[model samples]
Target: MRLLILGTGGMANAHAKNFSAIDGVEVVGGVDVDPSRVEAFNAMHNIPHGFGSLDAALNWGEFDAIANVTPDSVHHPTTMAALAAGKHVFCEKPLATDYARAIEMTEAAEAAGVVAMVNLTYRNVAQLQKARELVQAGELGKVKHFEASYLQSWLVSKAWGDWRTESQWLWRLSKKHGSNGTLGDIGIHILDFAVYGAGSDIDKVFCRLETFNKAEGDRIGEYDLDANDSFAMTAQLENGALGVVHATRWATGHFNELRLRVYGERGSVEVQHRHDWSKLFTCLGDDAETGKWTETEVPSVPTNYERFFEAVQMGRTLEPSFRHATSLQRVLDLSMLTDRDRREHEVYL
Candidate 1:
């Protein structure tokens, strides 16, 4: 499949590289607002075409699919446009900053009958897959509780946005941009992976959000620092399980760590995926050493890029689709709105 990657962010480059490495995929053109970055990205990837905007690319680019790699703000519009044009799309997560807009995007894609998937990349993690299998196979029988977190130290200092030449590390801190900072960014991944692996849906959320690392003085720039840097929530699952989910960008020692443990009546499983290493532990109900944990091998899952191409080329439905993001979007939207005024919020379906 030939593709046009919108937005010249680092993720755009990653998409280009991943697609290029696929068996029969090509990055035909790229679109970015910055002309210099457009030229640079194309030169770096050796793509045959470049455009100044998505409108221009949609008008003239030769591609059957689009990779919406833009910021969270533009996800709704760009993806809607791509679906309207009858093109398949691989959009970034959160679907949109607004729940209504996310619904519209998913509906548009569904109406178009196009393969649309949100870039919930962690869905491809092998350990998470293994955990999901354990839950599905009843190894962890009747899950009763769960604890999940995605932590990173990038926002502790000011180097979070040093990689990309955009927003001065404050877009996430902006209401007009990110809406829900750490929650929307990485916390959504925790919600997604935990529920996904546990094969359950969250039914309620009681949240606590913090802005401990808010920008001060000259650091605010043009963006507002009202967005949260850390968030902790107690979630009640549809399966009557109480779970804790936490995300913080100021986690001092952690680079990027996603850990989840699901406790069931008979057995339990703990899965950890870190930037450096990953591990999964399980305990069967009949283990003689009652509280013992044994390391289990993680299942090897396929990459999203490979799955996306396969879905597009084979006319199959995209798992972790925009629909899934819309589901997660509601959680983020409510998380953004939940505060001292409204302490506990019920997760809608």
Candidate 2:
């Protein structure tokens, strides 16, 4: 299996390195609008061919897969073009800046009959993998409640000066460019991994959105700060489990933390991020009340790139497929509507 990376951003290196490490997979080329960035990326990663534009990569046509790690706004166009060119796609999360475009992208991939996977990075967390396995194996019985949060302090521009001065984060706060803001960036991942761990889909959402302290005039450049800094929602799953979901870049003490806990009839499981990694805990049996939580050692698992290559080789749909992404987008779309009316919205998939 051969691949073409779609961007020269920070994540493109990880993609190139991880795929290149696989025995049968090769990263044949890379595409980026900036020729100098492309040059640097190739120099750093040894990607044999680099293209100034995606069209160039499409014309070269030597790869069977696309690692679509481009910006939020351009995901739809890049993934669609690659899919149309008869390549499988591994897209970065928040499938598109807009929900409608996300739907269209998934539909196109399905119609093209290619395996598709969204890089919901949280799903790759070792502890979360254990949580997912526990949920599926009934070690956690029928889940009754779920709670998750992803918090970060990057937007605490005081420590790093104004992030609005940086090119990397400027567009991320734009309503048109960033779309749902922190919700799309970090919130979607919480919802994704929560749904994955719970072994069900969310059916409704009642949400609160905040753009509070991060104001439009507070930025350095002529930037758009229309996106939210935080979002919290109460969600109901298809399995009758209730949950709370939260994501923010404003939590003062948290550098970056994502935590998830699920309670079921027979057991309960929890996972927490620590220093960019994770820890898993499980409480089972009648000892649940009296016994201390036992830390479950998470086993090793394949990287998203490895899974993508495996799916391509096996001719099967990948886990956390484009279909799942559309459902997650449904939750986000309805959450926006819920915020508007201050009412619960059905997540109609």
Candidate 3:
């Protein structure tokens, strides 16, 4: 597979490295609005071609697939262009800024009959995969409740760098810069984590979003820190499970963490991915009687990058597909309305 990385941002490095490492895949080129950045990305990845824009790269048309590491708002147009050009696409999360655009992209990918997938990075966690497996196999015996959270201290700590001065960090805090704040950023992630781990879809959601003041003026040069910093959601799953999903950049002490706990009539499962490490625990059978949780060893699973390559090769769409992402985006869209109306909203995919 000849792959073109669609953006030269920080995430593009991971895309280039991972795809280049695949035996049958090659990172042939990179695209960025900044010529210098694209050139530097090509050099760093030992890529042969660099284009200043997606249009330029599409006109050249040498690559078989595209790794879309573009910003949340740019995913729609670029991905539509790639699909129109008959190229498979692996896009970053949130699919698009809103459900209308996301559904359009999803329909386009379907109509184009191409392999289109989203990079909901948490899907790579072995513990999350195992937890879902247990729930599906009835080991959890009908999930009744679940709680999931995506936490980061980037706003409070310099562990990830200063958000006040960095464009990369600031862009995520500004709505005009194509950001939906923590709700649109990490909220989609934990929402996916909760629903996927519970092995069900979200049926309804009630969300509350908050944006804490970071700077005195709440303005950082061209970027306005008006985007939400935190969001808490109450969701009802299709399997009759009630779940709480939330995310925040104000979570002090934690650099980056994703945790989910699913409770069922017969058993309970817990999965945690902190920093880069993941662990799984379960209370089942006799252990459930005593409420004793025992840690379990989970086998590793393929990353989203690997799965995308395989899906393209096999001519099949995979989970985290454009359609699935659009479904999640539907929930996210309704979440905003729920917050606005101060009431729960039913999710319709």
The best candidate in terms of lDDT:
3
* Weakest 10 consecutive residues of candidate 1 by summed lDDT: 156-165
Backbone clashes for every candidate come to 0, 0, 0
* TM-scores, one per candidate: 0.94, 0.95, 0.99
Question: Which candidate should be chosen as best, given TM-score against the real structure?
Answer: 3
lDDT of 2 by residue, 192-252 (tens): 8788888889988999998865654745466668788899999999999999999988888
lDDT of 1 by residue, 1-349 (tens): 9988999887887898999999899889989999999999999999999999888988895898998989888898888888889999998887788789999998998899999988898887888888888898988788899999998887654345451235646676677665677887887789998899888888888788887635454246567677778888888888898899998887888878899999998888888988878888888778624788889875577888888999998886578888888888887777766756467788773
What are the clashing pairs of model 3? none
Candidate 3 global TM-score: 0.99
Which 10-residue window in model 2 sums to the lowest lDDT? 213-222
Q: lDDT for every model?
A: 0.83, 0.85, 0.92
lDDT of 3 by residue, 173-274 (tens): 999999999989988888889889999999989999998888889999998989999999999999889989989998899999999999999999999999
The whole-model C-alpha lDDT of candidate 3 against the native structure comes to 0.92
Better of 2 and 3 by TM-score: 3
